[model samples]
Target: AVLGQRHEKNFRPIHYASKIITEAELNYTTTEKEMLAVVKVQLNELNELRDQAYENSLIYKEKTNRLHNSNIKDRVFNIGDRILLFNSRLKIFSGKLKSRWSGLFSISYVFPYGTVELSQPDEPSFKVNGHRLKHYFGGDRPKLVVPDLQTFPKDQ
Candidate 1:
C-alpha cells in the first residue's frame, strides 16, 4: 500500500509491535539438539554396555569360582587349582588358581560365544578380558572361547 502511494508521498500512520528475536538463542538451541543426538545418546549406550559387561563378568566369574571352591578340582580343573586358557589365537593361557579366562578380562562376560549368542549386547557370552587373563589362568580352559586379545581394545 505504501509503495503504491507515490506522488507527494503523504504520511500515513505508524504502528509498532513489541517483539524480540535473539540470534544467539536460536543458535544455542540448534547446537544443543545436535549434541544430544550425537554425544549424549551414544555415550549412554556405551556406558550401559560397559556396565552390563562388568555385571555379567562378575556373575560369570563368581559362578565359575564356585566350581573352584567346591573342591572339585578333578572335575573342573585337572591341573590342580590352576587353569589353562587358549584364546582365539591358540595362545596358551596359564594361571595360578582358576580358569585362564579370568585373568584376561576385568569383565569377562562381555565376549560373544558365537554369532548367534553374540548378536545381542544383553546376551554377551563370557569372553576373557585378554589383557589380564594371563595373570590368573592360562589361555585354555574347559570350553571357554575368548576373542583375539592382541587386536581387541579395552572396554570403554
Candidate 2:
C-alpha cells in the first residue's frame, strides 16, 4: 500500500497495488522473496537502489542502536540512595519547557522487576518504576582524592 502524507500530517492511501504469487515463487526463501518482489514490481534500477538503500539504512540503525545501548551502564540504587524520578504523566498547566524529573527522593525499599519505593522527609512513600529513577549526587563533590600516579610505586 502506498500512502501519502495529508495536510494534517495523516496518511492517505494514494495508491494500492497487489499481486498474486505463483506456487514456484512461494517456494523461494525469505531473502529471495524480497528481491523477487522488487523484480516483480518492475521498478526501475534507481527505484530498486532506493528501496535497497532504505533496507540497508534500517539494518545500520539496528546495529547502531545495539552498540549505543551496550555502552549505557546499568544503574543500581541502594535502599538509602537519593534519586530523581521521571514524571511521564502529563499535567494540566505544565508546559513543554517544564522539567520532567522531580526528586531527591530517598529509596526506602527496592522490589523485584524494577519497582522502587521512594519517600521524602515530609512526604509519604510511593512506588515507581526503577527505570524512571536516576542517582542524585546531592550537590556534593566526591571526597576521594587521587594521589599522583606519575612515579612508579616505591620498590617495596
Among all candidates shown, the one with the greatest lDDT:
2
- Give per-residue CA lDDT, model 2, range 32-70, as digits (tens): 766665564556556889999999999999999999999
Local distance difference test scores for all models: 0.42, 0.79
TM-score for all models, in order of appearance: 0.28, 0.48
Candidate 1: regions farther than 4 A off = 1-26, 29-32, 72-156
Model 1: weakest 10-residue lDDT segment is: 112-121
lDDT for model 2: 0.79
33-84 per-residue lDDT for model 1 (tens digits): 4443455456767999999999999999999999888975322211123322
RMSD of 2: 20.4
Q: CA lDDT of 140 in candidate 1? A: 41
Best by TM-score: 2
